[model samples]
Target: MAKIDKSKELDITIPEEFALRDEVRFLKSEDIKLFRLLRESMNKIEPAYVATYPPSECGIATFTKDVVTSVAKYTPFSKPIVVAVRREHEIEPYERIVRFQIYKEQRESYLEAARFLNNSHADIVSVQHEYGIYGGPDGEYILDFLEALEKPAVATLHTVLQNPSPNQKRIVQEIIRLCDVSIVMVRVGRQILLDVYGADPQKVTVIPHGVPNVHRVPAARVKRALGMADNAIISTFGLINRGKGIEYVIQAMPKIVERHPTAIYLVLGETHPGVRKYEGETYRNMLIELVAQLGMEKHVRFNNRFLSLDELVRYLCATDVYVTPYLNKDQITSGTLAYALGCGKAIVSTPYLYAEEVLADGRGLLVDFASPDSIADAIIRILDDPELKESLEAAAYRYGRRAAWFNVAVDYLGLFHRVLNRRRLAKELAESAQSTGKSASK
Candidate 1:
């Protein structure tokens, strides 16, 4: 206890002998109950309203679908809806959740989509940005949409080229300038946006690509289920395109087969719809011819179908060593590679931007781009040493757990709430200041 100083004259004073007591306080049981109620109320949140890509054959569509589903688990109050992006000539029955549609090739459609979003009840407009998904040269029409948009926006860039053209650079800069914030899957992407494009450093965030919350199934069990129990499986799964460098994976098969006759390389997924539309199946045929040329027909098989989510997971679980032989060194993101990371398979990949980051620290093995010998040597090392394979898978699985969809979804909600709150605060402050000024003038 400390005695109060009553010696001096004051407007308010304690008694001459008054002393203040200091003691630790404890909450009553009833107060604790009230506190619990208050905490629960604080933790509860309203659902986020997002308008972005819907389910389709595109990998971006699949990613959007996963985002919607995963985000729903954390916020159960309401559901997230979509605004599907379609080809100019396509008309298909979309889900009821799809409130509207935007065509890829029509310039007028972008403005209309913007109008629709501004009038709608959406809280935020999410742009699943890829160069081909939007209209105009280098997707310039998206800039129009963002310009006209009144609602807050968040742009998730699927591709961030290291060396972009003048138009590409301009569009990306405009998007960051217009949107409340922007998201990229890797740190290198954030760095590129800063160093190359001069994007606002504070505007960009790095949230990793999401992967399904999958249970690890034993390779033998899944391999037997797929009728490949006796053979070792090395596989790549993604929409086939010239950029995938499938030919290198094929070329590596002859050498792989020489060491282990039962080793099979499965090339999964159909030709990319965009590639099929523009270039036809020339790339697929070339890969088939190369496989035949090597006399590795039985060892290398192609599953020419679009794999459903379950099917993709099954194939990944069955894979002893997963391969990603992407040729583009500047390629920023790969959904298939993210999935393989999630599945915690022994990954052998060309050192593309994403691979170099995700596969670092022995999480996976990296090889030279378009080099079969490099890929073959990496795969053979994993196959020969069970302990090494286990070590790689263990490390990958640990990392993937940190990047699970659930965590990613929560990160998104956190960012959204922070943004919304800051805006709300600024508006309140401005209104209060205006009211004070009016009162002072009187």
Candidate 2:
């Protein structure tokens, strides 16, 4: 067995292949220990405002909520407030959370909201960047917001497009250029912006998304709830969309069943709301028909409902082999991959950019893109090779423990501290320069 470095994913070294944007390195051996000391010694820091899209019915919204809660609980000094377009999913509204509504028709309203947040006592403004959510191709609203609030801001890039349009590329680049510090969930994400989109490499930071302790129910308990018995289940979780390439997984299923008759393919999560209008259950219906055509109706299960966090964790734990057949190569942060890693489940995914970076730790299997045969081969290889499965499980378990939410929170704190320090330094330099100029004039 290979020696697994138990440091969390966020702490993992960026592969030398990518051009690093920010000078920020994942915690060094000494730095990790230092952060531990700071964690104990430092006073609580309050974040005045966090700017993300409205708390809508989406993963980004859910992640934003979790991050805010974590920041508040972990940082004693900072009680950060959420600046949102709309309060979409408020399971429990906290007093620290504030809302800023921006309708599509009102461009001036967006500026006003930005001004309000800027004028407030917010120390650092953290913006979650996804071009689709903001206005125009290059996130013009982001520019407006940043301009309005000359205060220091950090951006967490959520979606890095694999094939970006000219305008989309420009917007992402502009956002990266303007941000004081840019965060990405994975190194692969940073590379896309720098290498592919030609964005400034010096401003980007890698802060892999963290797993919350809230969803860490016992594996057996979770599996039992899903009614998954002793059968080996290979499941694909998350919103169903064209990019997910779920049909490829379904295609690979027939071949998998030929070898392991008891193998079941569980297609979890709902189709994305954005794509439902054009595709209206067409993909799900097609997969069902394919299962019937392939004569493996019993071997496939379609749990096509929007699963709560608890249920999703149960499904992840219950799954023997998790398959991500996404066609998109630029997908950086996959919630499915994180949950699967959290459960320490063996993964078999297509060769997406993040998959290569993640699987490099020997945590999972990666197959060629858009190839059903390759996908089937990877799945079968895992099932047949006990040693391989054990190795993957062990590696994944080691990785998951470090990538846990608390560890991620610690890394984020480091980033916050860095940005704050940089801002202070810049201010000091300006003041010094001003003083020197006045003396020269006299």
Candidate 3:
């Protein structure tokens, strides 16, 4: 770690830093609690006013809520504010933290929301970016919001496509340019932003997806509580849709059930709102019918409800094997996968970009995409070999402990502190330069 020189010119360019715009490194370097206290005593990083999306049923909404909670743990004085986005036809109740709302299809709504934040005491803006959640072509309306924002901002991009369309390329590039700092869950996302979107590397920070800061519990204990002590729970969770490739997992269940009679597959989650609005429950019905046709109705279960954090965590704790059969090969992040890993389950996933990187080094098993046989074989391998399963569980648990939300918050606040410091230094430099010019004239 490079130390800052206090004697350096305060009115000129700030000194270069070995670790800037990130706190993950800081947490890893020293004791998190002690270092945070030390920094607070030396120079208190005040509680920043952050405006972001409020909690909802969607992935991005839930993500924003969790982040706000973790950030609040450090900044107890002023909790982050919310600028929740509402779908055109949806009218869900929100918490009081939601100071403003942006209607998805209304162009002017974005401008108004931005202005609302600008007028508030918000020191910074936090964006939970996703193409589907925002309005306009390729979610270009977010550009308007970011453009109108007057405060320092950081955006956490949920999706990073390797081969994005021209419109998507434009929107993401603009987002990177507008924000003070950009965060990605994986290094793969950072590379795509640089090589594909031509973003500034220095502005991009890799903060692994934040998981609940909970320790691994005994699987048997949770299974017994759920009244499935005799069964091996194979679970997949998230907003279910065609993109989830759940049918393939169900198709693989017959083979798995034949080999291990106690193995039961659990598809946990309600249909995605976007999918439900247009297609209804057509896709979910298809999977249910397939289960019947295979005569494996008893072997599979569907919890057709949007689970709360507590319910979701309870099931996750009981899970023996977690699977993500998503078809999209380009997906850069999966909250479901992160939670599964955090719970220390033996994960069996398709070789999606996020899975490939995180599940590397023998942490989890990966099979061919959309291949039921491959999926079955991998699940069986884990079930059949106790040592392999234990190793994967151990590795996943270790990584989960490191990537927990509290540690991730350390990185977030670290980056926030850096931005604030830079702004202060720049203001001083400008004032000093103006004073020198006046003296010369006299």
Candidate 4:
């Protein structure tokens, strides 16, 4: 069944005789030891082993993995168990890249993993809250797991819905009630949770997702290496889904080309597994069809595959401007949005919850969602006005400095410490109450 297509096969040939060169950035033994010491110091606290409940495949899983990795590097004392419900085909993606063992099967297995974490010495368990990650139909299992768990827990809400199903609303409310803490990524997301879902603000903490400090290589070299022309490239990276508004971006492309003639739209990343509504090549081919229909065959490019962190950094830096025309109101924490900002690419995004809030600080340009003309106009504004472009780029980099991984790591640690302190106080209170009752009995 594995038919090899010569046309589709990538021609990625490296020269054999070329010697690899190093720029002599070697660290001294003392320096190495200091680095290790620093890394370990950050991770020294005995964190209650965390079991992150995330979807099988998609950005949520990727973000969860990144959080685990960041915690391991900086907060190494925290043992993390990543529980996933994966299909046979999706298994390799996790195995090849994440290198962590994941549990596969139904919602019961997910609950079992949560229960196991609860029974363990884990101080706290963190669930990456998204409706799709929980059980289908009734969504009864998430509540069941929470009720079963005796240990303190936190639920990081990945999506903040504008109009949620009654069941979705109920489950989310129950989650908020069950968990010790609820963390969100943006201000608007927090607002939506409170206003729409009636979540208590006291319970929710707004900590933006941090972007790792990735090296930005020159676009010219990367483009040449990738066999692409030395031209201005615009990129939109993330799994392709209908709610992502990729089709609208493609529609905006013709107009963008009319202004910046040589501009190419490079859509990086693949279809997310959570996007069951538009699975596999269905969404991809539809975008391709739109590209062809718009006569943007030469100008538009697609990379429907998993990209290494280095590759992602390279492509993001290579982009002249990044576009995220998402129509989803629920996308609260956008790693794509963060990645674009971190790279300091002059961005044009729809006024989604995060974009509307974060970009208000003038980090990036914003347009109305679903309006191809609005997207096109924003793209043209950046392309035409160098002053504006530079302003946005500088602002983005400034914002990135604050939103860096190290800073975010510190914030998460603070939250962890607070959660631990709260737990300690609760224990003391319970002991006091019990001791008083014993004295009364005596």
Compute each candidate's TM-score over C-alphas.
0.88, 0.83, 0.88, 0.82
Alpha-carbon runs more than 4 Å astray in model 4? 1-56, 87-107, 215-229, 274-279
RMSD in angstroms between candidate 1 and the native structure over all alpha carbons = 16.7
Better of 3 and 4 by lDDT: 3
Best by lDDT: 3
Model 2 weakest lDDT span, ten residues long = 8-17
Model 4, span 141-237: residue lDDT tens: 6677788778777778887787888987888888899988888888887887789878888888888888866544444555555554456688898
**What are the runs in model 3 whose C-alpha is more than 4 Å off?**
1-55
Clashing pairs in 1: none
The 10 consecutive residues of candidate 1 with the worst lDDT sum are 17-26
lDDT of 2 by residue, 1-442 (tens): 1232334112111123221111113333447775566556755555544444322556776677767755655654345766765423434233446655544334575677777777776777788777655554455666666667666778888888868888777777777777788889888888777888777777888987776453333444444444544466799988888889887877888889889877888898888766786879887788789888888788888877888776776577767788989998877778778768876888999878777787777899999888889999999999899789878877876777777766787777777788888889999999999999999999
lDDT tens digits by residue: candidate 1, 148-213:
888778888988989899889898999899988999999998999999999988899988999876
| lDDT score, candidate 1 | 0.80
lDDT of 1 at 193: 95
User: Judged by lDDT relative to the true structure, which candidate is superior, 2 or 3?
Assistant: 3
Q: What are the Cα lDDT values of the candidates?
A: 0.80, 0.72, 0.83, 0.71
Candidate ranking (lDDT, best to worst): 3, 1, 2, 4
